[model samples]
Every structure is written in structure tokens, then in C-alpha cells.
Target chain A: MEIFIALLKGLLPVAYLICLWFYGQLFFSADETKQSRWAKLSVAIAVCMHTALLFSLAAQYHRCPLWTQGEALLFLAWMLAIVHLLSEWSADTRRLGFFTLGPAAFCATVALSFLGKELMLDAQYRSSWFIFHIVASLAAYAAFSLAAVLAALYLTLHRKLKLKTFDLTFRKLPPLDKLDKLSAMWSFLGTLLMLASTVIGVWWVRRDGLHGMSPREIGIFVVLAIFLFTAAARRTLGWRGRRHAIWILAGFAALVLANLAGLHGFHF
Target chain B: MILNAPSQPQVFVLGANHLTASVSLRDRLLLDEKSIQEFAETLLKDGVVKELSILSTCNRSEIYGMAEDPKAARTHIENAWAARRNVSEDEIRTHGYFLSETEAIRHLFRVMGSLDSMVLGEMQILGQVKDSYQLASQNGWTDFYLNHIFQSGFHTGKRIHSETTIHEGAVSISYAAVELARKVLGDLRGRVVGVVGAGEMGELAAQHLHKAGARSFLFFNRSMGPAERMAAAFGGESRLLSELQEHMGQCDIVISATGAPDIVITREHVQGALRHRHGRPLFLVDIAAPRDIDPLVGEIENTFLFTIDDLKNAVSGNLELRRQEAHKAEAIVEEEAARIESWSRALGVVPVLRTLREKYQAITDREIEKWAAGQPPELRTHLESLGRGLLNKFLHAPTTRLKQLGEQGDGSRASYYADLLFALAREEKQHGD
Candidate 1:
């Protein structure tokens, strides 16, 4: 069983490579939007392999595989893959897979490197409150990451329009208004999840009287504040275009910082 | 089965354009709406062609049809067009080029792509082509062959434009005016366009703007008659030029193209219009030679003023870009035309396949019935199965080979199959003899 888990973990990268090959075909084909079967199939297969790997890890740990912060990374990657499939199904856009799945594959690979460490399962992790807090926080991170990618694309299209440079790539991207709306939708959802997670964390702290605020807590508050400010700007300042995209990028930076800084048990 | 001769292509097109004929001659040969219907009926009655459509524009006049005798049909159209325009046969011969079969299909595709227009990448040709097609359709002049050809032409035209950057910029001055309005206000579906002046340029600009999806229109001229005429033409309301300022406040775009020697639209009136506009952007296109609108109106906030010179400069800049894009369009046209030609060539194999199937089925049915006569029910079933299997076995080689020949562009293979079908039936009959 151990060897099988290891082999499956190793196959994730191979699956990503196959997906990349199919993605290149979809991106480069002149007129085959309705014929991207290989890309879809490879993504579905990669997602299945990742799911099996997660289940195997859960079996070994005797818990939901997300007991430690490192395990949360794998859950986040799974959310990324699932979100990408959902976006494709909803938007009918194949171009987004490379952006979404490329980061997902990278995160999964990083999670695999952390497999030799202890699972860190304890009584506190078994509590439903801690589980919801961690899972919701990671899911929000996934949403913000998707928003950041869309914001970056919006800025690229904005730059191209300002420069008056038209090309096939420019033509293939979603319309500017649609991109702005999608990015805003994702940011709004992310902000709601982040607020919910923060509320849960505060309740936990009050109930247990744990360690005081740390750098990771500050990072989370700052990220949450940035997104709330962006939401306010949309109505008050009529914020859109370059300014809106920049706000999402800034929030994404804070999200990355929080993930890196949250370690010493003083963090959410 | 009566199979069509393989070498005589059915579809043909004959036309003279700005490239082939003088503008005066093209103008004389132009067919109006009623004349188009008349000519369609006349050509169908001539018996030389079974299908007909006349695409008459200021730049060109062309006839598209399906003909029994492609060459004779070409001459018949040439003679008819000459008689209608009161020109001589020698004149039509000198000016017109007759296109048959693949050339006709290729030429239609090129025309649809605007590669054959006077100005490269002009979009009006597409609308004119569609109108001609619709006219032909309504008159019942379009048969299956013409229908397929026109539909394919429309699809190929759309594919070329979308896949290539051929139609990147506006090529005409009037359309350039509309494009300028659209650049500031994306999607002009709900926008109001006010045409101030009844000049030819103003009318043309309004027509193009309306086609681009501007819903509301206001026509203003010093004379009420001209204003009403313009209003009736564009499906809009007419307001006297004296009352232009009162109505200008409601318009999103104002086109100034009056024949007045002085400025017809002043800065003060435009600035006042901006006040009522509530910061919404206003586009002013002053396409008069003597300069109709005040250029100072451009300095006002939220107002874009473009004059005749600005439009001219825009046209020149876009013309260079269009020239470059037209190169890509040429390759696209060539590729798609070849694709359409290949389709028509494949059409040639249809009758051959039909004839082969019918002839073999008849031979198998007759032979099986004769052999099964006076036999028991079990023996008859077995004999019928044997005949069916033998027919399939016999046809497997030739039908596959014929389809392969069609794919390989072997025209004579169709004729060869034609002869072989007859010879095989005859040989089977002789064996029975």
C-alpha cells in the first residue's frame, strides 16, 4: 500500500505533463474549440489520480488527510483542480486549464515532498471546529489564487488595448467586461470565505485562550482588509480596469505571505 | 439513370467590376430591385440557365446562376446585359470576364471576402452579396446548386474575416465616421445618431451608422424637404436645422456635413449640449470640406470632435494597415476557395455512386428472382442471400476505388465508372444469352 501511494504520487507529475501536451494542442489549434477531448480527458485522469493519493494519505493518517498545515496544501491543490473543471464546465473555456492546473500540479508536487514528515494528528485537529477553520481558509486561498490569475490576464488585455496591438491571443481571451466580472465574483466569494474562517478562528481563540496574535494572523487580517477595501471601491469609486486588477494582485500577495508565515501555532 | 456529363460544370458567374469595366459602364448596367426580379425571370426563361441572381452595386454588376450549358449561358448573360445597358456585344466582350465552375466559385469567395472590392477589405460588398442572395432566394431563382454555393460563400466569407485580421479597420470614409463613434461608445445598439445636413456624405454616414446598430436617428437640414427625405430614408424623424440645438442635446453622436460656407455647428451650442448630456461622451463627426463643426468643441471635456481632415488622416492610416491585412486575406481566400472547389468536385461522385448502386441492385434482383423460381422456400432464402452477398463482394472493390479516385481528383475516373457500369450490365446480359 505504501509503494502504491508513492507510485501514484509520482504519477501526478506525469499526468500534469500529459495535460500540458494536450493543453498546447488546444491553445495552438486554429479552429478546434469543440474538439479538445484529449485535454479534458487528461485533466479528468490527473484529478482522479490526485483524489486516490489523497484517500491513501487519509487511510494512513487515520483522519481526513488535512491534519497538518502541509496536508492543507494538498487539499488546496485539489480545490484548484476541482475549480478548474468547474470553470471549464460553466464558462466553456478551455484556455483556463493551463493557468489553473499548472499551479495545481506545482502545489501537489510540493505536498508530495512533505510526505516523509509526521502527520501531526492530535486531539485538537480531530475537533470539527479546527477542521472547518483550516478547510475553509484553504478553500478561500484557492479562490483568491484563481482571482489573481484572472486579474493578471485582465491587466495583460488592458495593456494590449492601450498599446493598440491586436493578435490572435488578444482575440482569444475573454471580453474585458466578462473578465472583470469573473474576477470580481471570485474575489467576493474569497472574501466571504476568509471572513467566515476569521470568525471561526476568533471563536476558537476566545474559547481556549491560546497564544496571542502573530505575524501570520496579521497577514491574514491585512489580506482580508485589502479585499474588503476593494469591494468598497467598486461601489464608491466605481473602481474598474487597471485599478481593480491591481487590488486583486495585492490581495494575492498578502495571501502568499500568510501561508508562508503561519507556522508556530500562534497563527489561524 | 440519366447522369450529367462529368466535364460540363453546372455553376457559372459572369460579371464586370471596377477592375474590369469603367465606372460609367457599370453604372449603366446596375439593376434595381424590380429589375433584378425581371432579369432573374428572363434568365430562367431563356432555358440556357436554370438558376439566376444579379448582384448589382455601384462598383460592380455580376450574374450568378446554375446553367445547363455553362458556355452558352455565359454568352446569353453577356448579350442580355449588353442589351439592357444599350452597349454593344464587343463592349461587353472587352469589359467582362466569364467564370465557370471552380473559377466561378473562387471568384464568388473572393468577392465575398472583399478582396475584389475597389477598396481592399471594404465591408459593403458583403452586405451587397447577401442582399443579392436574399433577392435570388425570394424570387425562387435559387436551386440546390446555387443555394449550396451561396451558403458556402457566406460561411467561407465569415470564416476568413474572423480567422484573419483582414477586416481590422474601416476602409470607407462614411464607415470610418461610424467607427469613430463606436470606438468611444462600444456597442451602439442603443445610441442616438443625429445627422445635421442633407449632403450626400451626411446621408451615407447616417446609413452606415444605422447599419452598425444605432437605433434612434435625427435628420436636420435647412430645408424641410431634404430633412424629410433623409428622415424617410433612414427610418428617423426630421427636425429643421433651426431647431438642431434643441434636439442635439439628446443625441449621443452628432454628424455635421452641411453645405454651409461657414461653421454650421458652433462651440457654444455643443458646450451647452454637453451640459444636458450628464457627462456621457459625445462624438462629433464634421465631414464637410469647408469645416462644419467647430474644432474647439474637441477641447471640451467628454466631447470628441473629428473633422473632415481627421477622418481623411484616419482613412489613410487604416488604408496602409488594410493593405497589409489584405495580403493575409488573399491567402485565406485562396485556401477557402480551394476548399469549396474540392467540395464541388466531390459532388461529381454522387451521381456516379447512385448509378452504380442502382445498376448492381437491378442486376442482382433480376438474377436472384430467375434462379429462385420453382425452388422451395428454404432454397429461395439461401439463393437470395447468396445474390446479396455476391453483389456486395462485387461492389466492394469498385466503389472503394471510385471514392479513392474522387479524393485523388481523378475526373476521368467518373467517366470510366460510367462506361464500366454499362459494360458490366451488358456483359452479364450476354452471359445469360
Candidate 2:
């Protein structure tokens, strides 16, 4: 079982890399639509492999795959892949996979690099509510990451349109308004999930009678506030286009920092 | 049973296109629906062609047919076409080509795939070809040969479109404008389109935008008369050019082609409009000579400004891309034409196969009679069945090989070799004697 788990952990990044390569070929090739079937098959295979690996880790560790930053990152990569597949399915835009899956594969590789050194699961990982908190928080992060990728694409396309550089990349991107709307949708979902996870964290801490909040907890609040403000400004203040995309990207950066600064300090 | 001789009908096309004839000549050669029907009926009645279909468009006039004598048929078609159009035969012969067999099939494939079109990668030719085929089939002017060829042509065209990026982008200026609008604003439905010139260019731009599903139109001209007329035509409101800035915020796409000598829409004007736009991006197309919108307006955030030169550049770039994709389409056409030719060759050996089978059966029957005569009734019947089964088993591999050779474009030689190797004709002659 240990060997099997180790093999799966090793293969997870390879699967994602294959998925990313297929998607990249589909996006950058002249016969763009012809590669959709292969892209879909690779994505399905990689996602399934990632899912099995996560489940195997959970079963072996006797807890959710959220015990450490590395495991959490693997879980986050899985969520990102799932979200990407869902987004591609909903929007019928498979070209976005190149952008979405690149970061997903990178995260998987980085997570794998932390294999032998970070196998020691924390002893403090106990209550079911902690699983919920970590899962929701990571899922929120995945959504924000997707939003940032889309925001970056939006900015690129925005500049391309302004510069009148009607090249292959310009042709491959989705319409600007559609990208904007999709980015906003992901941002809103991330804000809601972040808010829910924060609420769940406070409830868990109170029920357990934890004394004080960590700086990381305070950082999460700040990131959550930034997303909340982004959503509100987009809705009420009519902040859209460049302002909207830049704001989402900034919020995602803050969230990344908050997570990195507190990589090993998430204890209830 | 005696089989009729193979007809050996050849597929052929005689036509003139933009490359071969001037516009006036092509226009003169145009045949209306009724005239095309008359010409098809006459040719069919005269037995000049076995099957016929005529494709007449503004840029090309083509006659696709199958006949026993392509040279005579070509002459007949040219003469008839000239007489119908009241043109001289010399004029028709000078401008048109008479291609037969594989060349004809290749030409038809190219036509259906839009590689032969005046505007490369345009999709209208596919529909025109379909309409012509449908018309010919409905009038009983087409048979299996013509039907298969046209169907293959359609399939090839569809494959070329889906497999290559030939017809992926807009080619014309007005359509390119609408494409830019779509790229920037997503769906054009319910988007307000502001037309600033009310001239031919503006009308053309508006027409393309409407075709792209933009229903709301705002027409502005230096004078209110033309603007109102244009607005009424598109079922939208009209305004004077002087009041353009006041209502510019209402439009999502603004196409300015006014005849003003200097810059009519300044950076400040767009700045004022963007303030009221609430972060919505505005796409402005200045198609006027000397430009209507300020160049500095393009530098503003959330405002995408394009001039006539930009759109022209896009059009040229798309044309170049189409030219590259046309190479892929031509390769597909060549492949499909070769396939059809191979299939046609295979078809030519059908009679030979039937004759060979009949001769082998006769030989088997004679042998069964000669050997089984002395056996008991049951034994003789068993011998008969065994002899026939042996003959069939012996023939299976050779028959498959013969058909394979035929499809590989050696049907005539294969047929000759089958006759000599099996002594089929000699056996038949000896039986007759």
C-alpha cells in the first residue's frame, strides 16, 4: 500500500503535465478544434488519477488530505483541475485549459517535491470541522486562482485589442465581455466560500475555546475583505474591465501571500 | 445472361470564372432557374450528356456532367450555352475550359471547398453548389455518378472547413468591423450601434452589425435628413452630428465615417462619454478618410479605437491566413478526387467479374456431369455440391485481388489478365462451337 501510494504520488504530476501539453497544443495549433477530443480525454485521465491519489492519501493517513501544506496544495491542485473542467464544460471554451492547467500542474509538481520531507502529519489535525475549514479555504483559493488566470488573460486580450495585434493568441481567446463575466463569477464564488470558511473557522475556534487568533488567521481575514470589496465594487460601484480584472488579480496575490506566510501555522 | 457493354462515361466540366472571363462576360453567361432547366432538358433529350448540373453564380458559371464522348459533349454544351446567351461560340471557347475525368472531379472538389472561389475561403460557394445539385436532382438530370461526385464534394468541403482554419475569420472590411465588435463586446444582441456617417460605408457597417444581431441603431450625420432616413430604414433613432457627444454614451459600438475634414470626435469627447459609461468598454471604428475620431482617444483606458487602416490591415491579414489554409484545402480536394477516381475505376470491372464467375460456374457444371455420371444418385448429388463449393473457394481470393487491383487504378489491365489467366472467353467460344 505504501509503495502504491508512493507510485501514485509520483504519477500525479506526470498525468497533469500530459493534460497541460494536450491543452497547449489545442490552443496554439492551427487546427485548434481537432485536438478537443484528445484534450478532453487527457484531462479526464489526469483528473481521475489525481482524485485516486488524493483518496489514497486520505485512506493511508487516516485523515483528510489537508494535514500539511503540501497535502493541502495537492488537494488545491485537484480542485483547480475539477474547476477548470467544469468551467470548460459550462462555457464550451476548451482553450482556457492551457492557462488553467499550467498552474494546476505546477502546483502538483511543487507538492510532489515536498514528498519525503513533509510526510509527517500534524498531531493537531482532529475534528471534522477542521476538515471542512481547510477544504473550504482551499476550494476558495482554487476559485481565486482561476479568477486571477482569467483576469490575466483579460488584460492580455485587452491590450491586444488596443494594440490591434490580431494574432493567433488574440483569435484563440474568448470574447472580452465573456472573460470578464466568467472572471467575475469565479471571484464572487471565491468570496462566498472564503466567507463561509472564515465563519466556520470562528465557530470551530469558539467551540474548542481557542484563545487568540494567529497572524495567518488575520491575513485570511484581510484577503477575504479584499475579495468582498472587489465583489461589492463590481456590483454597486460599477468597477469593471481593467479595474475589475486588476482588483481580482491583486486579491488573489494577497491570498497567495497569506497562505504562504502561514504555510505550517493553521491550527485550531 | 448477356451483359451490355460498359458505357465508359466520362465526367467533365466546362466553365468560365473570374480568372477566365471579365465580369461582363460572366454576367452575360448567367442562366436563370428557368433557363437552366431548359438547357438541362434539352441536353438530356438530345442525349448529349448522361447526367448534368449547372452552377451559375456572379463570379462563375460551370456545367458539370457525365457523358460517353466528352469532346463532343463539350462542343455541344459550349454551342448551346453561347446560343442561349446570344454570344459567339468563339467567345465561349476562348474564355472557358473543357476538363474531363479526374481533372473535372478535382475542379468540382475545389469549387465546393471554396478554393476556386473569387474570394478564397468564402462559404457561399458551398451553398450555391448544394442548390445547383439539388435543382439538378429534382429535375431528374442527375444519376448515381453525378450524385456520388457531388456528395463527395460536399463531404470534402465540410471536412476542409472543420479540419482547416480557412473560413475561420472575417475577410471583408465591414464584416471585420463587426468581428472586432464581437471580440470586444461579446454578444452584439441588444447592443446599441452608433453610425456617424449615414453614407454607404456607414450603411454597410450597420448592415453587417445588424446581421451579427445588433438590433439597436443610432444614426448620426452632419445633417439631420440623412440620419433620419438611415434611422428609419434600420428602425432606430436619428440624431444630428452636432449632438453626437451628448448621445455617444448610449452606444456600445460607434462607427464614425463622417466626411468632416478635421477630427470630429476628440479625446475629451470620448472621455466625457466614458465617464457616463460606468466602466463599460466602448469600441469606436473611424472609417473616414483623414479620420473622424482623435488618435489620442485610442490611448484612453477601456476605449478601443480603430481606424480604416486598422480594419484594412485586419482584412489583409485574414486574407493571408486564408491563403495559407487554402493549401490545406487543396490537398483535401486532391485526396477526395483521387478517391472518387479509384472508386470509379473499381466500378468499371463489375461486368468482368460477373462474366468470370459465369464461366467458372459453367466449367464446374461440365466437370460435375462428366465425372458423376457413373455414381449412385445420392453420390452424384454430393459430388455436384462439392464441385461447386470447390470452384467458389478457388475463385474467392482471385476475385478479391482483382477488385483490389481495380481500385488501385489498374482495372482495365486486371480485367484483361483475368480473361487470359482463366481462359474465360476461350471457354465461352468453345462452348458456343
Candidate 3:
């Protein structure tokens, strides 16, 4: 059972790499009419494999896959893949897949390496509320990560346009305005999820009479505040383009740092 | 350079194009769709050409045909074209060029692939070719030879279109604006495009943007009459020059092509529009000769500005890239033309092989009848089937070798050798004839 689980976990990144390669071909190649079907199929295959791996891991451990840091990393990667697929379908922007899948593959690889060393299951593994909180937080992180990726793409394209390069990368990227809008959209969703996760965490803390805030909680609060400010500024002050994209990237960086510190046993 | 023998049907093409004739002469020699159909039918019905298709575009007029007597067919086409257009035969002879056999095959491929077009790598020639071929096919004027050439031509065109960057970028000034807008703004649906000056360039730019999926347009001119006229033409609203800044905020793309001696759109105008735009970028194109928009407006945040020189530079670059890609496309045409020629050559031996097979079957049938004379009815039928099967098996090896020789362009000599070896009697008439 352990061998099978490890094998499935190891295969996760390979699936994502294949999916990425197909999307890369679809974007870089001039003929998209034929490569699109294979790209979509590859995404479906990767998503299905990741879903099966998560469920099998959950069954093997006889608990939700949100308890340990490694398992949570795996879940986060799965959520990112799900979010990418959903966005690709809803947005009609398949070219963004090449950008998003790279990180998903990298995260899965990291989780595989970490799992090989040890599975650091937390003490609050049995708490259902804690599981929900972790799930929401990771989901928010996934959304923020996607938003940052989009922002980076927007900046790259914007610079290329201003400079008038008109190179292959310039041709392959979605329009600057579309990228900006999609980045804002993902940031808005991430902020809402982060708020929900923060609220759940506070409620659980109060009910259980836990101690003061952890560093991870404070970091989430800061990231949440940045996104909220971004959403507010765009609405009230008309903040856009480079400033908006930079704000999203900074917020994502903060979120990543906070998660890393929290995983290292940093407390309030 | 003919791939087939002297006795085989030869492919021929005769035409005059932009390089060979002036616009006046080309226009005078023009054949419309109805006339092209009539012309093809007349030639096919009169036995002047075995198979025929005619392509008549504004830039060129050409006839592609297969005939046993290519010189006669060429002469007939020349006289007929001159008579129809009321032009002298001397005029036709002065402007026209004729190609036969392999030269004709290569010319057709190059035309379909757009390598021979006035604008290298233009895409309309392929569609024109397909239309011509379809007309011929519908009227039963074309057969296996013409069909093979057209199908191969289309394949080559498709390969060049997709595998190379020949048609990747805009080559004209007006279209460059639309291409730039698409790159900056992505899909232009639901986007408002503003046109200024009501000049020809502005109208052309607006037309391109409309085709690129922009629905709403606002035209601003110095006079209200031309603005309204342009607005009515594009289903857009007309605004005065005074309201340019007021309505500029609502526009995602603005094309300025006025004949004003000084800059009509200042930096302050763009700044005012940007304040009301709420973060959405603006694309501004200045196609005026004395430049209507301020060059400094390009420095403003969230505003992309292009002048006539910039558009020209983009177009020239794109054209250069297409020229490079044309070389690659020419290579593809050469390869595909050779392939079709080989396939056509292989068809020459098919008749000889069929006749040989028939002779063998006749001898086998005679022997089977004598052997089964005393057998039962069921047994006789089985014996006849078995003898025919053996005959086919015996001929299969030689048939494969003969096709190989034909495809290698030695078909006529191979057919003669097969006839001598088989001692088969020649038929008085070919199957289709």
C-alpha cells in the first residue's frame, strides 16, 4: 500500500509536465487548430490523475489529505490544477496554461521530495474545523498564485508592447488588458477565500480557547489586506496596469513566505 | 522536362499578370465568372482541351488545361480570348506567356501557394484557384489529371500557410493598426473605437477595426457633414472635433488621420481622457502626414500611441519576414509539384498492365473450359475461379514492377517492353475514349 501511494505521488509531477508540454506546443506552434484538442486532453488527464492520487492517499492514511504539510502541499498542487482547468474553460484562455502548470509541477515535485524524507503530520489533524480552515487557506493560496502568474504575464506583455518588440512571446501572450482583468479577478477570489479562512480560524480559536495569533495567521492577514486594498483602489481610485500587477505579485510573495514560516513551526 | 511521353496528354497554362501587362490591358482582357465558365465549357466541348479550369482575378487571368495537342489548344485559347474581349490577336501575343508540361505544373503550384502573386504570400490566390477548380468540376469539364494537379496544389498551399510564417503578420499600413490593437487589447469585441478627421486613412483603419470585432465606433471630423457621412457608413455615431476629448475617454482605440497642419490631439487631451478612463489603456494611431497627435502623448501611462512612420515600419518588417518565408514556400511548391508529376507518370503504365492481365485471363479461361468439359456444373465453376485466381497471382509481381518503373519516369519504355513480353494485341480504342 505504501509503495503504491508513493508511486502515484511520484507520477504526479510527470503528468503535469506532460500537460505543460502539450500547452507549450499549443501556444508556441502557429497551428492551434490541431494542438488544442491534445492540450485539453492532457489537462484532463493530469487533473484526473492528481485527483485519484489525493483520494488514494486520503484512504491510505485513513484521514483527510489536509493534515500533514506534505499532504497539504500535494492538495495545494491539486487545487491549483483544478483552478487552472476551471479558468481555462470559463475564460477561453488556454495559453495561460503554460504559465500556471509550471508552478503546479514544481510544487508537486517539492511535495514528493518532502514526502520522501518524512510526513510531518500536525497535532490538530483530528479537528474537522482545522481541516476546513487549512483547505480554505490553501485554496486561497492557489488562487493568489494564479493571480501572480497572470500579473507577471501582464507585465511582460505590457513591456513588450511599449517597446514594440513583437516577438514570439509577445505573439503568444493574451492581450495586456485581458491579462490585467483576469489578474484582478483571480486576486479578488483569493482575497475572498483568504477572508473566509481567516474567519474560520478565528472562530475555531475562540471556541477552543487557543492562545495568541501565529506568524502564519498574521502573514495571511497582511496578504489579505493587500488584496483587499487592491480591489478597493481599483474600484475607488482607478489603480491599474503596472501598479496593480506589482501589488498582486507582492501579496503572493508574502503568502508564500508566511506559509513557509508556518511550516517551519513558527508560532504567534 | 515533360514527365510523360510525347503521345501522353500534356498539361499547359497560358496567362498574363501584373508583371506582363499594364492595368489597362489586364482590365481589357478580364474574364468574369460567367465568362470563365463559358470559356472552359467551349474549349472542353470543342475538343480543343481534354480538361480545363480558368482562374480570372483582378490582377491576373489564366487557363490551366490538359490536351493532346497543346500548341493547338494554346492557339485556340489565344484567338478565343482575343475575340471575346474584342482585343487584337497581336495584343494578346504581346502580353501573354505560355507554359507547358513541367513548367505548367510548377506555375500552378506556385500560384496556388501564393509565391507567384503580386504580393508574395497573399492568401486569396488559393481560394481563387479552388473556385476555378470547383466550377470546372461542377460542369464536368475536369478529369483525373486536372483534379490531381489542383488537389496537390491545395495541399501545398495548406502546408505553406501553416508550417511557415508567410501569412503571420500584417503587410499594410491600415491593417497594422488593427494588428497592433489586437496585440495590446486582445479580443476587440465590445470595445469602442474612435476615428478622427473622417479622412481616407481613418476610414480604412476604422473598416479594419470593425472587421476585427469592434462594434461601437465614434467618428470626429472638423466638419459635421463628413463625420456624419462616415458614421452612417459604419453604423456609428458622428461627433464634432469639439467633442473629441469628451468622447475620447470612452474609446479603447482612437485613429487620428486628419489633414491638419498642426497636432490636433495634445498631451493634455490624452491626460484628460486618461483621468476618466479608470485604468483601461488607450491605443492611439496618428496616420496624418503632418501628424495630428502629439508625439509626447505616447509617454502617458496606459496610453499607446503610434504614428504613420511607426505603422510603415511595422508593415515593412512584416513584408520582409513574408519574403523570407516565401523562399520556404517555394521549396514546398517544388516538392509537391514533383510528387504530382511522379504520380501522373505512374498512371501511364496502368493500361498496358490491364491489357496484359486480360490476355492472361483469356488463355486461362480457354484451358479451364477444355479441362472442365466433362466435370459437373459446380466443379466447372470452381475450376474457372481457381484458374482466374492463379492468373492474377501470376501477374501481380510484374504489375508491381511496372508501376515502380512508371513512377520512376521510365513508364513509356516499360509499357513497350511489357507489350513485347506479353505479345498482347492492342485495342482499337482506349477505355474512356
Q: How far is candidate 1 from the true structure (C-alpha RMSD, Å)?
A: 6.6
Model 1 docking grade: incorrect
lDDT of 2 by residue, A102-197 (tens): 888998889888754665554554678888988898889889999999999999999999889999999999999999999999999999999888
Q: Candidate 1's residue-wise lDDT over B1-433, tens digit each?
A: 2345455348888888999999888888788998888777877885788887789999888898888688888788877777767777777778988888878888998899888988787767898999999989987888888898898888877876765556666667888777667655656888899999898998898889889898789999888999899888878999999998898989998998888999888889998886677545677888887988887887665567787776776677777867877777777777777776766666667666666777789888998889889989999899889988998998888777766666568745664666575664454455558
Clash-forming residue pairs, model 2: none
Segments of candidate 1 deviating more than 4 angstroms = A1-63, A68-71, A81-123, A157-182, A237-241, B1-7, B32-34, B44-46, B50-53, B66-69, B118-155, B168-359, B374-386, B406-422, B425-433
What lDDT score belongs to each candidate, Candidate 1 first?
0.78, 0.88, 0.85
Model 2 spans > 4 angstroms off:
A1-11, A60-62, A113-117, A211-215, A264-268, B1-7, B357-396, B426-433
- Per-residue alpha-carbon lDDT of candidate 2 for residues B1-433, written as tens digits (9 for 90 to 100): 2333388889999989999999999999899899999999988888879999999999999999999999999888888888899677888889878899999999999988989888899888999999999999999999999999999999999988888888878888999999999999999999999999878999999999999999999998888899999898899999888898999998999999888899989999999998888888899999999889999999998899999989999999999999998999999998999899888989877877888888888778888899888788998889888988898899899889988998997887888888788776676677779
Q: DockQ values for all predictions?
A: 0.14, 0.70, 0.51
Best by lDDT: 2
- TM-scores for all predictions: 0.72, 0.92, 0.88
Q: Compared with the real two-chain complex, what DockQ does model 3 have?
A: 0.51
Q: For residues A157-264, write the lDDT of model 3, one tens digit per residue.
A: 888877777777886788887889999998999898989988987887777656566677777778888899999998898889888999999999988888776643
Off by over 4 Å in 3: A1-15, A41-45, A64-66, A204-212, A264-268, B1-6, B88-90, B213-215, B356-401, B410-433
Docking level of model 3: medium
A185 Cα displacement, candidate 3 (Å): 2.0
| lDDT at residue B79 of model 1 (Cα atoms) | 77
**TM-score ranking of the models:** 2, 3, 1
